[model samples]
Target: MLEVVAVCDAILHSPWLLPVLVVLIAIDGPFPVLPSETLLMSAASVAFGTHNALAVTGLFVAALIGSVAGDFLVFGLGRSSHRVLARATECEGGLSSWVRRHLLLRPGTVLVGARFVPGGRLVSTAAAGRFGLDVPRFLVGSVASSAAWSVYMLLIGLLLGPITGGSPLLSLLAGAVMAVLTAGLFALVQRVRAYRARRALAAAQHPTEPPLVLVAPR
Candidate 1:
C-alpha cells in the first residue's frame, strides 16, 4: 500500500503530468476509451491538494487546448473520408441525421449540448466534416464545447478533493459517483427532448383526423 501510494504521489507531482493530460484529452476526442474526464478530474484533485489557483488554471488551459485540437483533427479525418469516398460514409453520417434533428439544429447548442452526450462529440465533429459544415462555424462550436467540458471536469475534481481530503482512492470513488450521476442526468434530458421532437414531427406530418359523423336518420 505504501509503495502504491508513493507511485501515485510521484505521478501527481511529476513534470510530465500536464503534458500527458494534454495528449490524453487530445486523443480522447477521436478515441473516447481514454477517459479524458476522469483524468481531468484526477488532475483537479491533485491541484486541490496544493490549494493553488494556478494549478487549476494550468489544467483548464491544457485540457481546453487538447480538446479543441482533437475536435479539429477528427473534423479533418471526416472531411478526408468524405473526399476520398466521394460520398458520406456510415462513420461520417451514422448519427448525423439524428444529430441534425435533435441536437445540431441550433448553432449554439451543437457543441455544448453534445458534450454531455456519450459518443456525441465524436459524431458531431465528424459530421461537420462529412457534411462540409463551414470551418469557422465548426471551430466556434468546438471552442465553446471544449471550454465548457474542461471547466466542468476541473470543478468536479476540485470539489471532490477537498471533500475527500486529497486521498486519491476516495477522490476517485466520489468522482465516479458524480460522473455517473451527471451522465444519467444528461441522458434523461436527451430522452425527454427526443420524445418531444418525435411527437412534434408526428403531429406535423399526420395532422388530426376529422371526427366521423352519421346523418342517416336525417
Candidate 2:
C-alpha cells in the first residue's frame, strides 16, 4: 500500500499528466499512448482517494473536450467521402447498410448508444458524417454521449477506491477488469441483436424456406 501510494503521489504531481490526457483523447490513429480510459481511471482513482475535486473536474472537462474534438475530426473525415460512402452503402448489411437502413433513421439513439460499444464511437461518428446527418443533431448527440461516458468511467474509479484500499493501481487494475467485462457484455448483446435481425431478414426473404435444425453427435 505504501508503494502504491508513493507511485500515485508521483504520478499525480507529474506536470505532464493533464496535457497527456487531453492530447491522447483528442487525437486518433498510430500514436503510442495508454488508452485514454486507463489514464482517466488512474487519475480518477487517485483523486477519489485524496478527495481531489479539482482532479475529477479536470478529468471530466478534458474528456468532454477531447472526445468531442476527436469525434468531430472523424466525422469530418467521413464527410469528405460522403458521396462515395452513400453510393457504397446503397445495398443492405454491414456498417454501410447499418448506416443506411438503420443509423440514418435514428441518429441520436445510435450516436449516444455507440459510445458504450467498443469501436462504436469512431464508427458511428464517421457514419453520421458519411451519411450526412444534420450537424446540429450530431453536436447534441456528441456532447450527450461524451458527458455520459465520462461520468460512467469516473463512477467506476470512485466505486473501486475503497475496495482497493485507496491504491490507484489496484483501482486501475480492478477497473480494467470491469471495463473488459462491460465491453464483452456489450459486444455479446450487439452480436445477439445482429443475429436476430439476420434471422428475421432471412425469414422475410424466404417465407416458404424450411428452417434448419441441429443435433448433437456422440
Candidate 3:
C-alpha cells in the first residue's frame, strides 16, 4: 500500500500527468473502469498542496476534453449500431422505451445526468445515438456535462484537501469513496423513480375495485 501510494504520488507529480489524464479520462467514457473522476479529484487535491492554480486549470481542460471525447466515441459506437435499434423492441414500456422517451423529451437531462452516474455516461450517450439524437445536440450535452463534471470533481477535491493534507493517495481514496456514495445515492433515486412510475402505470392499467355497495333493502 505504501509502495502504491508512492507510485501515485510519483505519477501525480510526473511531467506526463496531463497526457496520462487525457488518455485515462478518454477511455473512461466508454469504459467505466477508468472513468478518472477520483483521479482527477485527487489531482485537484494535490493542486492545493502544490499551490499551483495553473495546474488546476490545465487539469480541468484536459479532463473536459477527454471526457467529452470519450462520450463522443460511445455516441459514435451507438450510431454505428443502428441495426440493433432498427429491430423491434421486446417491450412497450421497459428500460429501452423509457430511455428513448426521456432522450426524446429531455436529451440534455439524460446526457448531463448520466455523466455523474456510474456507468451512466456510456449508456446514455449510446442511447442518444441509437435513438437518433443529432450531432449538434450531443455536442452541446457532452460539453455541458463534461464541464460540469470537471468543476464538481475539483470542488470535491478542494473540500477534501484540507483533511488529507493534499496527500495524493489519501485524496484518491477519499474521492473514490465519496464518488461511490454519491453514485449509489443517484442510482437509488433513479430506482425509486422507476418504481413509482411502474406502480403508477400498473394502477392506471388495473385500478383497485371500489368497496361493494349492498343496498338491496333500498
Candidate 4:
C-alpha cells in the first residue's frame, strides 16, 4: 500500500498528468460511474502538499471543463433520445416529473445540488434537455454546478492530503469516505423532504370531515 501510494504521489507531480486528469473528468459526465471525483481529489491532494499552484489550477480547470462538457453531452442525448428513452423506461415519467417540479424551478440550485447526489447529475441534465428547459438557462446552471463541484472535491482532497503528510492514497481514501458520507446524508434529507411533501399533498387533497349533529337522528 505504501509503495502504491509512493508511485501515485510521483505520478501526480508529472507534467503530463494534468491533461489526462482533465480528459477523465470531462468525459465522466456521460459516464457517472467514472472515478472523476476521485482523481480530482487525489490530484488536488498532491498539489496541496507540494504547493503546486499550476497543478492545482490545472486540476480545477480540467474538472470544471469535464463536468460541463459531460453535462451538455447528456443534455444533447436527452434532446435527441427523449421520446425513445422515455418510452423505453418505466421510471422515465417519474424522473422527468421530479426534475421538472423540483429542479426546473431553480435550475441553478438543483444543478449544483444534483452533483452531490449519486447519479443525479446525469438525470438532471438529461431531464433538463428532455423537458424543454431553456438552453441558455441550463448552461448558466451548468457552469455553476461544475464550478461548485470541482472546487468542493478538490478542496476536500487538498485538506485531507496535507493531514496525511502528502500521502495520495490516504488522502484519496479519506476524500472518498467523506464523499460517500455526504452523498448518503443528502439522500436521507431528500427522502425526508419527499415524505413531508407527500404528506402535505395528501392532507390538502383530503381534509377531515366534520361529525354530524346527534340531534338530527331524532
The most accurate candidate by TM-score is: 3
Model 3: per-residue Cα lDDT at residue 28: 79
**Which stretches in model 3 have alpha-carbon errors above 4 Å?**
1-6, 82-96, 213-218
lDDT per residue (tens digit) for residues 114-216 in model 3: 6776666767788887778899988998899899998988888788888778777788777778878888998798798789998998999999999998887
Q: Give the worst 10-residue stretch by lDDT in candidate 3.
A: 85-94
Model 1 quality (TM-score): 0.76
Model 4: pairs clashing at backbone N, Cα or C within 3 Å:
26-66
Worst 10 residues of 2 by lDDT: 28-37
> Please, what are the lDDT tens digits per residue for candidate 2 over residues 1-218?
55644654566568777777677777741122345676677678777877879888988998888888877877787788765434543545545456555676787777777778776676677778877888888898888988888898789878766776667567657656776787789879878988999899998998885777888898
Lowest summed lDDT across 10 adjacent residues in model 1 is found at 85-94
Name the candidate, 1 or 3, with the larger TM-score value. 3
Q: Residues 94-191, candidate 4, lDDT per residue (tens digit)?
A: 34456667766888877887777776787788877777779999999999999998889877867777675666676666656776787789878878
Q: Candidate 1: global Cα-lDDT?
A: 0.74
Tens digit per residue, CA lDDT, model 1, 62-162: 99899999988888888787453223324332245565654435654776777768777787777677667788888889999999988888878878887
- Candidate 3, pairs of clashing residues: none
- TM-score of the candidate numbered 3? 0.83
